[model samples]
Target: MFLALKEVGQSKIRYTLISLIMIAILFLVFFITGLANGLSFADSSSLQNLKTDYIVTNEEADGAVINSTLSEDQLKTIEEQLNQQSTPFSLTISAVEDKQGKEVNVAYFSVDTEKYSDIEIIEGKNISELTGNEVIINENIKNHGYELNDIIVDKISDTPMKIAGFSKNQTYTFLPVIYADFDLGMSNIYGDEPSYNAVLYTGEKVDISGFDTLTKNEAVKSIPGYTETQGSLMMMVVFLFIISAFVSTVFFFIITIQKLNQFGILKAVGADTKYIAKSIFIQVILLTTIGLSLSGLAIYGITQLLPGEMPFKISPTLMLGTAGLFLVLNLLGSLLSVYKVAKIDALEAIGRVE
Candidate 1:
């Protein structure tokens, strides 16, 4: 163990270079991990914000928010059974026109003002005061140069919804979510009964035996391409993990091979294989630990510099999981060198036969 670390210290330049390479890979993996989480959150944040135990939507939409439509009668029956805060739901064409009248696509949420607890109004007035076509927009809307009291015009067949408030973290399908009163939103989107396609049920137990009750996650899956979107992002995360593992392993193996003469000398001096292997393992672990520690600090620094709307989130569990995976792969990589050390003949040192 002492010799391995000492050798690294002596060849500080090489070790530093290797650690930097590992650090770069770690940064990339962590970045991709953040992106995957961002994508997942964007798909489901609106449903999560509903603060409901269960989310019931159209099974036909296949987990898509825009595709599902449920009758108000279907909604009323569920509320009577589950004691829910039912809101008539429909998605409007998401066109947000900034102060300059330039447009960006977004997701519009039409919810109940009376049951506004299901959603929060961070800036400006609540739904109760919303009247005369007033509509509340998401924080993402505000970030795009629209501010309080800004007029929001939907570039569709329907009338424009007035922007009354700025909101927080309401996103779906990677688009920001804007909220409006059910009466106003439904009339604009559907124009009558069954106008609202899905129902957001807030309760402990939802009895959908007569009908189907889909949780928020299930509701999301009901949207076509929802799960596939998440699955693809996860595939990228897994790819980054593989890259991190293979790169670290190969580097360690090569370094060990280069140190063969030192291992042979130690073996001739009666060093135990167990002790030698342990040292190699210790060296690999130490190197990885230092690299991760630096990367952890770097991630924090980088996320701080990111724009608020960027889908970058920090999760300790994910960071720990990624680090642990690298640690195991690094140790596994040292196995080849450990085996090579074990086979070194002590007789080679003296050139003598027993």
Candidate 2:
């Protein structure tokens, strides 16, 4: 360790350049990770906030809540079979014009407010308090210049709905969500059919002959594009990890070759191979540690400077997991150089028997 530190100190510029390169690579990984997480949250935050354990959808829908359709009779049967209260829910993609007459895309969700009551109202009352054409919208609506008591008109039906309140962090399918009374939302979308897209329930698993029961995790995974988007980002992350490992291996190998004569002298003077290997390992670990630390700090700082509208989030568990993977892979890559050091012959390296 002492010798490694001394050597690094002597080659400050080279080590610094390597650390900078590593920092750049890791920063990209962390930043992209944040983006992946943010996109996922945007895709499913509305459902996650429901805090329900199970979602009942039509078996034919194949785990897709958006594709599921449940009639009042079907919902009642499921409720009775499970002996639990259930909330009938439906969603539609619609455009709403803000107070300034600017149109914005929104996912309109309708549910029995009394049964669900899952949304957290940031500034005003819940959707249950909404009387005729009133609705509760996500706080993101405020960014578009709509606020409490503001009227937003549905582009399709030309129906003007009053924003009775605002909730925080409610999004669906990567769009801001508007929560409205089931009757009003159903009337606008279904014209008084008294039907819903799915049912939300809490408790142990319940098996209905014609319906599929999905956990929260399974439900999230079923969202369209959720799997594909996350999968692509993860592949990119893995590639970057492999590239970093390759860079570290090649860099360390070259450094070791350059110092072969010094290693040979140390070995001739009674230093064992194990001692030299330890020094190399310590150097690799130290470099990786410093690079990871700086990259983590950079991610935090950069995210703080980003605009609120940017869908970027940081999960501690994910960040730590990624960092741990990088460390392990880098160590493995550094082992190649360590192996070369072990093969260094004292006499040959010193030109005494070459």
Candidate 3:
């Protein structure tokens, strides 16, 4: 370790160059990872945040909540069969016009406020406390200049709804959500008759005939583009990991070759192969630690500076997992260099330059 630090200090520019390269590669990995997580959250947060365990949909809808419909008879049968209280909610895509006449797309979630209101209000009154056309919405809609007590017109129904409050992290299909009273939403947005898109079930198992049950996570896949988008971004992240390993391996392998003569001299002076290998290990550890730390900080700053509309989230689990994976890859990549150092013949390597 002492010798490794001495060498790095003496060859500051070389070590710095390699460290910079590591930082660049790691920065790209972290940024893309955060972007992927953010987009996934944006795509399914509305359902993810729901407290229910499974969603009961009409078997004919093929597990799609948007396409599912449960009549009053089916709802009663399901409640009785399961012998539990189930909350019926409806979700649909709609648009609202801001005061400036600009249209912003939104997912309208109509929940029975008295039965199940899982939305966490960040501002204003709770939806349960409101009536008629009053609604609570995702706080992100504030970005469109709509705020507490502001009125936004529903594009489809042409009904002006008051923004009673705002909730955080509520979205579906990459569109911010608006939570409305179940009965009122049916009258204004859906229709005059009472109907629901799906029922929220919190039971362990559901086997009712004529109905398909999906876990909350499984239901997110039913959202359009959720699977395809996640798969594509995840593939890019996997390739980046491969590239990091390759870059680290080649860089250290070449460096090891250049230091053969020095390694031979050290061995001739009584240093063992284990001692030499430890030096390479120490150097790799030091470089990776410094590089990943700096990259994490840089990515955090970039996420903060990014536009609010741009979906980007950074979580501690992701950062730690990424850093841990990177460190392991770099350590494994340096094994070739360690093996080269271990096999150096003191006499042959020393005489090569002569």
Best by lDDT: 3
Q: What's the residue-level lDDT of 56 in candidate 1? A: 61
Using alpha carbons, what is the TM-score of model 2? 0.93
Candidate 1 structure quality by residue, lDDT tens digits, 1-354: 687788788999998998898888888888888877877777777776765556665566655667666676766765666664665666765565677767788777776767656347688876667776787666777667877886667666346676787767688776777777765643354344436656666556565654556677677666557678778878987887777778877887787777766676787788878888988888888889988999989998999999887887759998999889878877887787788778867666445556
1-354: candidate 3 lDDT, tens digit per residue: 899999999999999999999999999999999999999998899889886888888988877788888888888888788777678878878898866789999988888777775568898978668778788899988888887898888888787888898988899987888887776653236666666778886768878888988888888988767899999999999999999989999999999999999999999999999999999999999999999999999998897789999889879898999999989998999999988988889998899554
Error of 2 at 39 (Å): 1.3
What overall lDDT goes with each candidate model? 0.73, 0.85, 0.86
lDDT, candidate 3, at 302: 92
* Candidate 2 local lDDT, 86-198, one digit each (tens): 78778778888766778899988888777875468888778667688888888988888877888888888787888888998799886888888876754346465755778
Q: What C-alpha lDDT, on a 0 to 100 scale, does residue 133 get in candidate 2? A: 81
TM-score of each: 0.86, 0.93, 0.95
Candidate 3 residue spans exceeding 4 A from truth: 186-192, 352-354
Better of 1 and 3 by lDDT: 3
In terms of TM-score, the best-performing candidate is 3
Worst window of 10 by summed lDDT in candidate 1 = 185-194
Residue 117 in candidate 3 has what lDDT?
54
